[model samples]
Target: MWWFWTLWAVVALTHCSAMDRNKDKALKLMKQTPLIDGHNDLPWQIRKQFNNQLSKVDLNTIQTTHTNIPKIKEGHLAAQFWSAYVPCDTQHKDAVRQTLDQIDIIHRMCDAYPESFMFATSSQDIMEAFIQNKTASLIGVEGGHSIDSSLGILRIMYRLGVRYLTLTHSCNTPWVDNWKVDTGTEAPVHNGLSPFGKQVIKEMNRLGMLIDLAHVSEKVMNQVLDLSKAPVIFSHSSAYSLCQHKRNVPDAVLKRVRDKAGIVMVNFYNDYVTCSQTANLSQVADHFDHIKKVAGHTVIGFGSDYDGVRRVPKGLEDVSKFPDLVAELLRRGWNDTEVRGALGENLLRVLKDVERVRDSLTKDQPDDVPIPYEQVENACRTNYGYFPLDNTGHSASQSPLVLALATLLCWFFGGSSYSCRP
Candidate 1:
């Protein structure tokens, strides 16, 4: 009996020792290869903390934030797609202006910390930033609303070094339904991508900007996979099969992403990563495992969604804890190469492919024309009829005067006017 007890203790000790060895091994692997996180909301954090002023925040040390210069270094983060996120509630023109402010903050933050950060607009730029021991700062606009139905704005965003643009956020864009609305939280505006939404993808390909499908409905995701000339990404999403969250990517979508040779960078938000309320670091690894199994190892990567979500997985509460995830993957039998791919290689490959598509389109002129404003506004009007806003700000859904005016306008406009249904 004593001998049996001793043997059990030895077995447990050996298992612990093995875990330590794998964790150590994972850390070493991260140093050799860069860990390019697809999304981080530090720019928003700065907006909240310092009112969009970089000087008010000291990133060199711990400062009540998930992402800081020191935390980024500790996490082995080589490159980051800083989210130029503006709330979807800030509609149309205001959303566009706020997005510009977010972009400006990102550029200034990178410039303010030149020694610790360097701006990266291309895959090569990311690698160069890594080589220089600086974290690459790549910009990713969070919603299509930022462009305000203007292809010209999209082109300008890309020229300003924006590498990716999420097709929608929590709310549906005029041309696309978002995941949240499609999940029944709200009425969907465009059941999927409308004609104009497809045009957005084409312009993105022409400009070399990666189409981020994080917050879009699955219908939109499938539509994009079918139409995009370049590989697309889900900048910060998890596997819906694992957690059943609407914010997560479905299995069917995962396979499509793999077929496109694109990547789905896993999100680390506790709610998205796990079905259980208590999310641990291991659950984060579980998402990586599930995506790799369903999508193949080539298309798996990390997006983290750091500073974006209110609750992060335990042990991955900040950017500094990234090595912990790498260690978990190693413990789960992932090889150094596969681990490296999840860390950054897969995203690099996709970004390079997007750039190649853009280069192929260099001779093509920009899709610079703006989609007409009234067309966007009336896209969801029932029976092609709209309710006019009264002086007190109430919508007059059945005003005879409004209906008569709409009929008169339709008669004069001809083809541009939609026929009002009874």
Candidate 2:
């Protein structure tokens, strides 16, 4: 019994020593590099719990379930892409308005707390904000339904400071299939990218928006990789090779990400990472390890999806626990370069590359393809101010007096490269 007690003391002291060493390493790394989280849904949380009102509560004093000013500061989050998330329930009804509302609140949050947060639209902006000792807040439209099949809306969103677009959520958009292609009972409508979907990819590339592949289907994943000229990002996804979840990125796609010079910011959702309602810090690290093994060290980053999901892995319960996760990684033998790359450098590199692609395409023709007439008409809440009519005021038809504007739109933009179905 005495020997057992002495052994326990030694084991406990060793554990504490290891934890302290890792924590120090994590702190040192975060201080030196900009730790940019690929996705956070604090805006969605504010919209839901606070009715999009910042005046009612102070992020400085009030504590949220997963995120807050103190937790963010403790976590050493230099930048975050606040997700403009609208539920799939709003797909055809009010997705656009809801997304805008979410984005508005995100802006309001940044404006409300200028001391802690600043609006950033580019990689350089993020670095500048970090140097100023502020968190760089960027916007990401979570689901394509927000676009309502209008490429015009997408462009307008980019001008509004939205930097990335998650091609789909849990449900399918008119243009792209979602992860449900593997999990749903129904057959896929497009199988992969519809004609309009291709235009979306092209337009996003032109706008320098990061093509986020998190919630898209496997086929859509491949199609996007094939179509997008810029390096893509799985804004909040993990390696499917470990979990076999449809929501996770498959190894085939990870290889494509590697070849395309993309990044996968590993998600901390329990079901995606552990396939269970519970997981620990080690389980999350396992994902980073697996992704690093398959996609290499540079392709890995963190997207905790904080405040977006109800359940998360244990030990990574809040935004403040990021350092703990880093510590675990360090304990598992991750060197400084590898750790720094995963922390923020890799994402910064991807952002710069995306901007480069945009610069390179400055002289190129912009995408002309509009969303197919039927797709928008069926899904959008309103069709006012849509495409104009023919000279004879005739609707879309195979008429000789000039086919419907829809037909003309398809012909004008789709050409032979797109199916342009109405």
| Cα-based lDDT at residue 239, candidate 1 | 94
Please, what is the whole-model Cα lDDT of each candidate in the order they appear? 0.86, 0.88
- What is the lDDT for 106 in model 1? 90
lDDT score, candidate 1, position 183: 68
How does each model score on TM-score?
0.87, 0.90
lDDT of 2 by residue, 1-422 (tens): 99999999999999999899999989999999999999998888888888888788778676766899999999999999999998887876668888899889989998889999999999999999989989999999999988888888998899999999999988888888999888875468898899999988998998999999999889999999999999999999988987889989998889899999999999999988888888888999999999898879989999989999889888998898999999999999999999999999999999999999999889878676677667756311334445555686543343443334444555566464233322
Clash count per candidate: 0, 1
Candidate 2 backbone collisions, by pair = 396-404
Worst 10 residues of 1 by lDDT: 378-387
Please give the lDDT score at residue 38 for candidate 2. Answer: 91
Where does model 1 exceed 4 Å of error?
1-12, 377-422
lDDT of 1 by residue, 357-392 (tens): 999999998775555445665422322224466676
lDDT of 2: 0.88
